[model samples]
Target: MQQMQVYARVITQLIASEDHTVQDLNSAISAVLRLNNINKSESPQHLKRVAHYSRLIATNCADTYSLSEEWIEHLYLFAPLHDIGKVFLPEKLLTKPGPLSPQEFERMKTHTLKGRDIIDHMIDSFGYKDHLHYTGMLRNIVTHHHETIDGKGYPYGLKGDEIPLEARIVAVADILDAMLTKRVYKEAWSMDKTLKELQKLSGSKLEPEFIGILASHKQELMNIRTASAE
Candidate 1:
């Protein structure tokens, strides 16, 4: 109990401090989720994998598009929170095995806004301004990660570059992880199959440039996934 209190205090301090690093935020987020019993997998490493793969995808995109290393790092840290809104979802809805009814799907869609709200609340409560850009990027990731290149995505149908670059990178990362993982409703897709699906969706469901970056760093991303699973 004492240790948990210390952890909570440290997390609160980091969130409130202006000098907090992305690494600090990442650790704090993980600790908070664990304390809340939010992640209950055998390995419970999905968030770490998502963070690693998101950063790799972002790095590849950053290099291909001539973005800064700082921006890429910000995407790495913020991508994990894209699903933070799931915390607002009922546990039954989140862990359901069957296909969602139309009503349930509608409820599920609220996660995007819920996630954005959580982060926004955190920013307001913590009063940290030094990482404003990071916070903005995280907000984009949470709110727009569902958006597609062809304007068919949810929350908003932002097309092409209208969506934030960080969100585009996260889209690739999130889909890749979801495709590769075995969920309650579906078996894991093979890497080859997943890559082919991504290719098929390149222009319509995903940004072509980001997909190109993902293709270029396929092995590196796979390596990160493999390492995280081990």
Candidate 2:
């Protein structure tokens, strides 16, 4: 995901106003999400699922991971931005019904890096780069969610626990949502099949512990998905 310089300028203008207030910052983030089609009309509740499952997993594993309540809330708010880079991609590539060409796949992989730059720009526009705890967490998810536990994943190839916890957590939520939802390339998968496929990826493409945590709350996740469908 090379920088989508074209969108950067437009999005910067959209976010260029005062962001000192919490309301202003939230509005800016919403504007960026809208540009990327993460809002309700565009994504058909995909962002809702990601945000719900991210929080669901964190809440279920809070004791194990020692996650503070505030951090859990942040994951809910920020996890959906993982695919913000797709705003830069052409519509044909985003909805192509077949496997991407090697060239296309390469272009697609840059979304994570591009997403990071988007967050960086947002933080810079807010003039609060000095206070980066929240922004840093968002940037980590944007850049690292696709990364795997093994050194095989893209962009930086960060292995094992080296990837940020927030990204690792969102990776599971993102994959789960993709599996349960129909896309141009594939039909929605059954819950049983989705779980088995994810199980195969555990410890290699995903954190085994988080997968287990998600499995333990299978009913809750299904409930969330069901609600999204309605």
Candidate 3:
């Protein structure tokens, strides 16, 4: 309990201090999540790729999305935290070799809500409840990234434009990386296959407008994916 208090104090000071750069804050957050056993079956580069992809998509659609540079940077930084809640999940379920049973799948779906609860605690502890673009954006990303455009997602059935834009963007970034990166359960998908699958998800599972924008930067995205593997 005393150690947790000290760690929390460090994180609060780190993020609350304007003297620290976004990169510094991002590193602090990453370190905390890693310490907690955040799981990513892909290489450590998974977060980097997702952040890069999310930034590219957000920048490309800046006009449509009304994104400012500062906001875009924050989005990139927070994008990687979307799955931070997975750390709370049982290691056995997370590393299970085969498909999960329906019960296990339901339990898995709780990660979104779990992520939100985690962020809520952090905001309360850090006293950032009033910071909309800061804590609020992160909360939205944690809770809504898995929601679908067609209202079929878990935790909440948010449909169409109802899902927060930041979450929607991270959703695309997260899915792309998950598909393209090799995991123990499956081989890495070819870029062509990944793109094809993403295209199919447009308007149903993802925002269709952003899908085209993301595809236009195929080469850059691929570069981010490969660079991480190195």
Each prediction's Cα lDDT score?
A: 0.72, 0.76, 0.78
Per-residue lDDT of 1-230 in model 1, one digit per residue for the tens? 34334433444454455466766776767766665435643123567677787777766656567888777766666666677666556777876898999999999899888767666666655565464566678779889999888998888889989998888878887888888888878898887788888899998988777667677777887787787773
Candidate 2, position 74, lDDT: 72
Question: TM-score winner among the candidates?
Answer: 3
What is the Cα-based TM-score of model 2?
A: 0.84
What are the C-alpha RMSDs, in order, of all predicted structures?
A: 4.3, 4.2, 2.5
Q: State, as a TM-score between 0 and 1, how close model 3 is to the true structure.
A: 0.89
The C-alpha TM-scores of every prediction are 0.84, 0.84, 0.89
Ranking by lDDT: 3, 2, 1
Model 2 spans with C-alpha error above 4 angstroms: 1-44, 131-133
> Superposing every Cα of model 1 onto the true structure, what RMSD results?
4.3
Separately for all candidates shown, the number of backbone clashes (residues 3 or more apart, or on different chains) is 0, 1, 0
